[model samples]
Target: MKILLTGITGQIGWELQRTLMTVGEVIPVRRNEMDLTQPNSISGTIQQVKPDLIVNPAAYTAVDKAESEPELAMAINGIAPGIMAESAKKVGAALIHYSTDYVFDGANTTPYTESDKPNPQNIYGKTKLVGEQAIASSGVPHLILRTSWVYGLRGKNFLLTMQKLAQEREEIKVVADQIGAPTWSRVIAETTAQILSQARHHVSDFLVSKGGLYHLTASGQTSWYTFAQAIFAHDVQHSERKLQNLIAITSKEYPTAAKRPAYSLLISQKLSNTFGLFLPDWQKTLELVLSE
Candidate 1:
C-alpha cells in the first residue's frame, strides 16, 4: 500500500516512519515540504501523492503559544486535517488523525471515555476539537486517536526538557495536581502501524461498528512531579546524571499562558476492545523510551 504521512519530523511522526515502513511504502512529508497552514497546499499535496492511506501527525502543538495565535492554530490543527480527509474521501483512502485529551475539560473525576462530551477549556483544545469535528463531518473513513502527555527521546517534549533541566539544575519543580497517562511516541507509532496494517478490514468494520474518536494512552496515570522523579531515578541508576532534589507543586504555582486541565486522564477500554491492543503502563513505556 502507498501511504502519505505528514509531520515526518515530529516525535510520533519520526517513529511512525520506521513502523510504517515495515507495512508498506510510506512517503513522509515534512513541514517545509508541505505546509499545513495552507488549505490548498494540503489538498494539492494529497492529490499529487494519491496515497492509499493518509496519516496526519502534524499539528499546532504549542499549547501556550496557541493562546496568542488562534487563527494559525485553527488553520494547522483544525482545518488542515479536514482538507486531507476530503482529499482521502475523493480517492477512497483511509485517513488517520491524532488528537489530544485536552479536548475535554478536566472537571470529571474519573477517566474520560469516547462517549464523553467535549468542552475544551483552552484554545489549543478547541482547535483540535474543531479538526476532529471537521474530519467526522467529511463522511470519510477515518480514525481519530486522542492521546495525552506524549513524549519521546527526540523532539522538544517533556522528557527532553526534564533531562536538560536535570543536567543543569540541582532541583526541579513540577506540578503534582495535574494527572494523566504519559504516552511514548514509539508506542503511538507502533499502534498506528498495527492498526494501519489491517486498515482495509478495520476501516470496514469501524464504519459499521465502533469507529470515531478513541483514547490511546498508557494504561496507568501519574502527575508531572512523580513522572519527573521517575525520570531522575532512572537516570541516576543507568546514567551519570544525579539529581539532588525534585519538588512537587500545584498548577497555580507554575503559571502558564494557557489553562490546563487538573485531570484529563482518558480511559481506553473502547480502543482495547475494538482493536485488541492494550498499551503497557506508563512506567514500563518510560523505561523503554529512556533505554532507547
Candidate 2:
C-alpha cells in the first residue's frame, strides 16, 4: 500500500510523515516536485507515483491575500483537487483530502453537521467548497475531512503568531467573537493514520461504504482571544518573554480582507460513529503540544 502524501513540508504533512510510515510506503511531494496550480502537473505526478492512496493537505492558505489572487486560489484549491481525484480514480486509489470549516457563513448558532448547507462568505471558502463538490461529484472513494481552527508548532498559524507576539510585545489583542475548535496538526495526522489502518485492513468496500464527508476536529470549541490567552499562560509566563496581558476584541474591530465565520464549530460525531475515534479538547491539545 503505497501512499502519495502532498504538502509534506506543511505542519500536518510533517507529522503525517512520521505517523503514515506505520501504514505503508509514504511518498512526500513538495511544491517544486508537483505544482498544484498546474492541472497537468498533478495528473502526471499521480500517474507516475501510482499510489494506492492520495492524501492532499496543500492549498493556497493565504486567507486575506486570496481575495486579491482569486485565479491562483481557484486553481490550487478548486481545480487541483478535482484533477487529483480524477487521477486517483484512474489508478483505483482512494483520496483523503483536508478541507476547512470556512465553507459556511457564520449564521448557524449550533455546531455544523455534514448535512448543513454551505454558504461561503469569502473567495477562499467558495473555492474550497468548489473543490469539495467536485471530488464528491467525481464518485471516487474519498474521505473529505472538514476541520477548523488548525494550528501547529511549525506553521503560520494563530498559536505561532501569538507566541511570537507575546515574546516581542508586552500585550496583544485577539478577536473573541470567532468560535471554533483549535485542532493540533499532530492530532489530525495521527487520526488519519488510524482511519487508514482500519480501511486497509478491510476490503475496498470499507472505503466505498464510509467514503463520504466527515467532521474531524477537536472536541470542544473556543474563541481566538481565549485560545491565545491559554497559550500565553501555559509557556510565556515561564519563559523570559514576560507577556503582560491579552485584550479581547470583537471581529469588527480587527477586520481582514477575507470574511471569517463567527461560529464555525463542527461536530465530529460523524467521524466518531464511523471510525470510533475522537480528539481531545482544544485547550488540552494546546497544552499537550506545548508540553512536547
Candidate 3:
C-alpha cells in the first residue's frame, strides 16, 4: 500500500515518518512541496501522488498567534482538510487528521469525551473545529484524532521550553489553574501506526465501523506547575541540571491573547474501545521522553 504523509517537519509528523515506514511506502511531503493554504494545490498534489492513505499531521498550531491571523488559521486548519478529504474520496483513499483540545471551551470538570459538543472560544479552536466538521461532512473515510498538550524531545514545545528555563533561570513560574495531560509525539506516532495497521489489516470494516473522531492523549492529568516541577526533578536526577524556586501561579497572573480551557483533559475510553489500545501514564511517557 502507498501512503501520503504531510507535515514531515513537525514533531508528530517527523516521528510519524519513522512509525509509518513499518506499514508501507510513505510519500512524505513538506510545506514546500504542498502548501495547505492553497486548496487547489492540495487536490492536485493528492491526485498526482494517488496515495492509498493520506496522513495530515500538519496544522496551524500557534495558539496565541492564531488570534491575530484567524484567516490564515482557518485556511490551513479548516479549509485545507476539506479539500484533502475531497481529493482522498475521489481516489478511494482514507484520510487521517489531527486536531487539538482547544475545540472545547475548557469549562468541564471531567475529561472531554468524543460525544461532547464542541464550543470553541478562540480562533485556533474555531478553525480546528471547522476542519473536523469539514472532514466529517465529506463522504470520505477519515479518522480525526484530537490530542492535547503535545510535546516531544525535538519540538518547540512545553518540555523543551521548560528544559531551557531550567538551564537559564534559577527560578520559574508556571500556571497552576490549567490542567491536562502532557502527551509525547513519539507515543502519538506509535498510536497512529497501530490504528493504521488495524485499518489496513481489517480493510472492510475499518472506515465503516471504526473511522471517526477519537481522543488520543497520554494518561493522567496535571497542572503546568506540577508538570514543570516533575520535569525539573527528573532533570536534576538524570542530569547535572539545577533549578530552584519553582513558583505556581494562577492563569490570571500570565495573560495571553487566547483564552485557554481551565481543564482540557480528554478521556480516551472511546479510542481505547475502538482500537484496543491504551497509552502509558503521562509521567512514564515523560520519563521515556527525557531519557531519549
| Cα lDDT, all candidates | 0.87, 0.89, 0.90
Better of 1 and 2 by lDDT: 2
Off by over 4 Å in 3: 201-205, 236-242
Tens digits of per-residue lDDT, candidate 1, 1-292, equal 7889999889999999999998788999988778998877888888889887888989999999999999999999999989998988887777889999999899999999989999998999999999999999998878899999999988899888998887777778999999999999999999988876665544534543545788999999999989988887666443545457889999999999989999999998988888899989999988877776
TM-score of 1: 0.95
Please count the clashing residue pairs in each candidate, in the order shown.
Answer: 0, 0, 0
Q: Write the per-residue lDDT of candidate 3 for residues 163-220, one digit (tens) a residue.
A: 8877777778899999999999999999999887887654325876778899999999
Q: Model 1 segments beyond 4 Å from truth?
A: 200-210, 236-242
Query: In model 2, which residue pairs have backbone atoms overlapping below 3 Å?
Result: none
**What are the clashing pairs of model 3?**
none
**lDDT score for candidate 1 against the true structure:** 0.87
Summarize candidate 2's per-residue lDDT along 5-63 as a digit string, tens digits: 99888888899989999988899999998999998899999999988889998887889
Error of 2 at 227 (Å): 0.3
Q: Return whichever of 1 and 2 wins on TM-score.
A: 2
Per-candidate TM equals 0.95, 0.97, 0.97
Q: Supply candidate 3's per-residue lDDT for 124.
A: 96
